[model samples]
Target: MLQKILRIPWIARRTNHNILQELGMKESQLLKNIKQLKLKYFGHVVRHNNLERLCLEGAVEGRRGRGRPRRRWTQDISDWLGFSVREASILSQDRDGFRSAVWEATSYSYKDPP
Candidate 1:
């Protein structure tokens, strides 16, 4: 889509990185933003003692299906923060700490062209 917008043909051999650089875009901008938002929302939900939190924590029991186990939302949060879901939940209690952790977890640093 970007290539079409830029009128660059496939035969031009223009790399995606080059195109993104031309457009002044960080490659991970969209993904990073999504991660940041997800983390922040998770923190919000964790701070509350509601149905949402219970569901997120897998406290609401239900039947399991056959084959591979489904991945949980907290798993993604744990992967991103390099901490267990329980620890992350505890940290989320501290608003400032959670915010800083989310920022650090999702931040992307773009290197200047040489």
Candidate 2:
């Protein structure tokens, strides 16, 4: 299921409905599990504001929001899973800020791992 999420492009919270459907998850359950996974592994909560922003920014509209939006794992999640903590740590002093920085760096096509 995680792999499936990773494979999709331009994922956002709004479009995550389909991804959750594809994974056989209810909206509430999906959000619960995502939060659980994030906290368990990253030791931090996935902010609701961030989730909303991710949905808005990452969504791929089929026809200017008329059709279902395409979903992909948020760049933050993608980079977090792909990049090492040490690399993220060196990027910013604040934990959340570092994560954001790493995500932005990777999202903008920076190839360096750190």
Candidate 3:
């Protein structure tokens, strides 16, 4: 779709990375934004004693199929921030600390422009 918008022909045989470089697009910007949003929402949910928080805390009652247990949403948070969900939940209580942590976590996933 971006190629179509940029009117770049396939005949040129340009790679998506090349096109993105030409356009000066930060490849990981979208991923960074998504991670930041998810983290912020996580903090919001953690701060509230609501249904969403319950679900996030894995309070759902259901039997899994006979296979490996499915990864929970909290797994991604753990992977991104290098902190266990419980620790993250505790950290989220401090808005400034959580915000700084989120920024630090997402910042490492992208490169600064030269």
The most accurate candidate by lDDT is 3
**lDDT (Cα, tens digit) per residue for candidate 1, span 1-114:** 789988999999999889989888876875687799899999999999998887886664587889998898778999999999999989999999988899888864555223
* TM-score quality measure for candidate 1: 0.68
Tell me which of candidates 1 and 3 scores higher on lDDT: 3
lDDT of each: 0.85, 0.47, 0.86
Q: Model 1: which ten-residue window has the lowest total lDDT?
A: 105-114
Higher-scoring candidate on TM-score, 1 or 3: 3
Give the 10-residue window scoring lowest on summed lDDT in candidate 3: 105-114
TM-score of 3: 0.71
Candidate 1: give the clashing pairs: none
Number of clashes found in candidate 3: 0
Better of 1 and 2 by lDDT: 1
Candidates 2 and 3, the one with greater lDDT: 3
